[model samples]
Target: MASTAITTLSGGLVSVQASLQSRSKTLGLNLSCSKSVSAIRGLKVASNVQIDSSFLGKASNSSLWASVVSKPEEKQVFSSQLQPQASFKVAVLGAAGGIGQPLGLLIKMSPLVSALHLYDIANVKGVAADLSHCNTPSQVLDFTGPSELANCLKGADVVVIPAGVPRKPGMTRDDLFNINAGIVKTLVEAVADNCPDAFIHIISNPVNSTIPIAAELLKQKGVYNPKKLFGVTTLDVVRANTFIAQKKELKLIDVDVPVIGGHAGITILPLLSKTRPMVTFSNEEVKELTVRIQNAGTEVVEAKAGAGSATLSMAYAAARFVESSLRALDGDRDVYECSFVQSELTELPFFASRVKLGQKGIEAFVSADLEGLSEYESKALEALKPELKASIEKGVAFVHKTAATAAST
Candidate 1:
């Protein structure tokens, strides 16, 4: 048997030697390893020693492996700690799109997700089949066409809609909204009919508008739950954290920036003055960072040369939001994330800011972050109101127009 010694700051040098054999009945893998690092915490072995079996698993079963795998039945007990049980069904709309496929794969890997339903109008079956082969605990199901959409949402605890058209270079928001708004309307209706109580995450572009579109459709269906609706603006926050960390030479993991306002253009606001661990930014630095964060989507789209939009990063951010939402539903009290939802934080009907998530959805909004905005941020906040309000009204108006047209027909 192989042995490895790991030196911890407090534990000095500790030697670990073990021959481990574990079986994951779901994936049907015989996991055997001669050496493993169980745990080292405060000179004592902590029960949760995450194992990396990426290279150890068979080629066919490799997709099933998690970066951190904890087996509780090992003969040499490292510790008694175990992660919380996995419990939640997450449905991903537009699972075949640029963002949706990767989003489905990420969600499929989550131990908290018990079932992942992938729904798209076309080519979703292959996406589902491919994701189903992963060794993760979640069961993957694909739903194709409008006929199967309701079935996909049925019994879901969380419904994430990234299912609209991606923004291409030179495409106006109205052009994007005209196409995506209809898609969102159709999908939100399905969610209302099948999973009215499921936490709805609207990731479709022009989110400032689509979110209102979703809200109105849900209201039409008599299933609108303000607390359960969320517009995933996590990408703005993710971009802000990354850019700020790089510019400030701060540890990325230690940095947190709250992005408020809407999810597009000038509407995305990164509250840099309020960044955790409190970093100072020159006025020029603040302006540059805010512009970059606001236009990060366009930056990616231009870089991709219209090949695609910000699919991967958007997928990652959506996954982060999904995980946070799941954690909140799992009763983890510390879960907080920035999301666009029905709000009174500003005069707008909807806004994006840091929110305390709970089992019942958004439990509270962190309004203090908006209290003391810097001069530039305050001015930017005021400047964005008109555009953000216009987007919200556009979405709300689209719903009413469609309804009126249908009634006339």
Candidate 2:
């Protein structure tokens, strides 16, 4: 006979209810079958046996209360019941490139990822295959060549594009516009189709131009979420912290320098005055630090002596941004990181600043950094708007033209 029991383990109290088989047997048989309580420490088994021999067999069946430990599926169900639903699946487009490979590895290390998808025109199979060996729970999928771009993007929560040609010594982001612009546009089109709601992070440089290009393409697709798109400008902030600490004889880990404005030359504004735990600097020191931060990329380009431009450091910076986004996705209450995004913080169409990240992305823009710009910075900030605006317009125009042609065909 089957019996149900509710037992209090702490006090060793076991209460059981059983529907006993009422046979035409004598009253002595029923009295002798008084439920046996097996004093098992972990599981309490109270058995109501119908027959003499079968009573012991039923008492041994204590699997249900054997241990309160849960199976994987049961644990998952319990966890989901306790926590809110998870959101955000980060995608790395061009995950095979120099920056993308290392960046992809770092992102896979994050606990916030539910799924990671990799897209590239070549060699991505090897990249994905290598990353899949990692112990992290994130599942990596690779899409090779243009044909598979759509599949790579489908259901992505956050799409990061680091897919573009590296900058040569003499070339500006404008020089890269001819080629990288086309690459960014094609991939973003797939994103619009497959995962329109995903937060888009642009790491392909001329980020100053490519970010604008990304915005324009999304606008054309009619799925533009201004808060959802970002240019990964964490590299500038990384450089600022490194350089400021080195010069001032301060600890690098403690220094926090806020780099603002556009990502390129003359436009890249490092707010020296805003350095945390506030240190006062002389006029010459300020000028030197500003120049160093602005030309740090060029310094790397020159120092590599013709090998490459800032791949390792840039990868680290990009990876850090990926972590911040992941943390926000994991239902973190206050995840804020510096990024370049479409903003009205300044007159510029897009500005790089610290933004609070949430479920919907970009919860609040940190304009506190811009409140007390030096006179020199105020002038520089104003001057950057027109050039930045023009660059944005150029990108918007290019996508409109390309999209128009595709529609016609």
List TM-scores for all candidates, in order.
Answer: 0.83, 0.76
Per candidate, the number of residue pairs that clash is: 1, 0
Q: List the residue pairs that clash in candidate 1.
A: 64-135
**Residue-by-residue lDDT tens digits, candidate 2, 1-409:** 2332223232333222111222110011112233242332211242221122232322211111121122223222111111113434788998999889988887775545658888888889999999998755578888898788888888888888989998776777567887899888888888998999988889887777788888887887899999889898888888888788888887554567777887888778888888964898888888888888889887988898878888888887887677666556655555667788989887777888888888788999989989988887788778777777777777777777877888999
Clashing pairs in 2: none
> Candidate 1 lDDT (Cα, whole model)?
0.78
lDDT of each: 0.78, 0.70
RMSD of each: 9.0, 17.9
Q: Please identify model 1 stretches exceeding 4 Å from their true place.
A: 1-84
Worst 10 contiguous positions by lDDT, candidate 2: 21-30
Superposition error at 347 for model 2 (Å) = 2.0
